[model samples]
Target: MEPILALLTAKDTKEALAAFKELEANCLAEPIYADTLESFLPALTAENSCGRGRAFKFFAINARWDSQAVIEKHLTDILGILDDSKAPTLRQCIPYLTYLAEAKPELIPIICEKLDSLALDQYKESMQSLIRRDIEKVLSEFNC
Candidate 1:
């Protein structure tokens, strides 16, 4: 496992963010860093906000390079996290959705359905609106 993967599990958000940034920088210089997706999936769905945020940030940076794996292995998990109540997490998920929209158009309907079903019951009106706007943007990109 890479040292950067350890940072995704860090208890401190700042530390995790720093590690994510480092991984992003390294991935730019060494594309192989993107291959760590399988190891990072657990962190992406972690109970800790920091872990989830950092993992999503990493995927946003690298998803394009590993689009097939992301689509086949993690699409549902990504959609599952699209709750409007978690505004930040919802925001983090949008870029992955965008990448998938371009890379896998066949999945658009499924993604749209999941987006439509995302519960907004716990969110404020403003957050719900923001989530809807983002979801619409992604869906529109796919012509959904």
Candidate 2:
């Protein structure tokens, strides 16, 4: 985990976030572990696109455990990352945002707005999968 924190300031955030995700997986149930993650997540999230990739890693781990509070709190940050025309940031963020949105279903309306605003030609299948899976999860949750 120490190395992961270092990665936050690494020359590459993509690699750092990837490292953090690995650490989170191994330490999910630790008593103070989530708090450590909480601190890193906000700081990394506040960073620009270089930090966007890392932010998704935090969002993904929190979402996997149904951490609605974490997801809800960062909803706007996730959306802001998505709104960027920067492919590297978008590539790192959209899927994680999709998962985050699932944990906080009330965010769907804004997410849908973001989707509509996207230049679809810029979206590849992976990006499309994000939206599709989100729709399925939310609809299923509503029994629709």
Specify the highest-TM-score model's number: 1
Distance from true position, residue 98, model 2, in Å?
A: 3.5
Q: Scored by CA lDDT, what does every candidate get? A: 0.67, 0.56
How well is each residue in 57-89 modelled by candidate 2, as lDDT tens digits?
A: 555556646443555575566566665555666
Expressed as tens digits, the lDDT of each residue in 74-126 for candidate 1 is 76665566652467767766756665555556767887888778787677788
Off by over 4 Å in 1: 11-15, 28-30, 67-70
Write out the backbone clash pairs for model 2. none
Score residue 111 of candidate 1 by CA lDDT: 77
Best by lDDT: 1
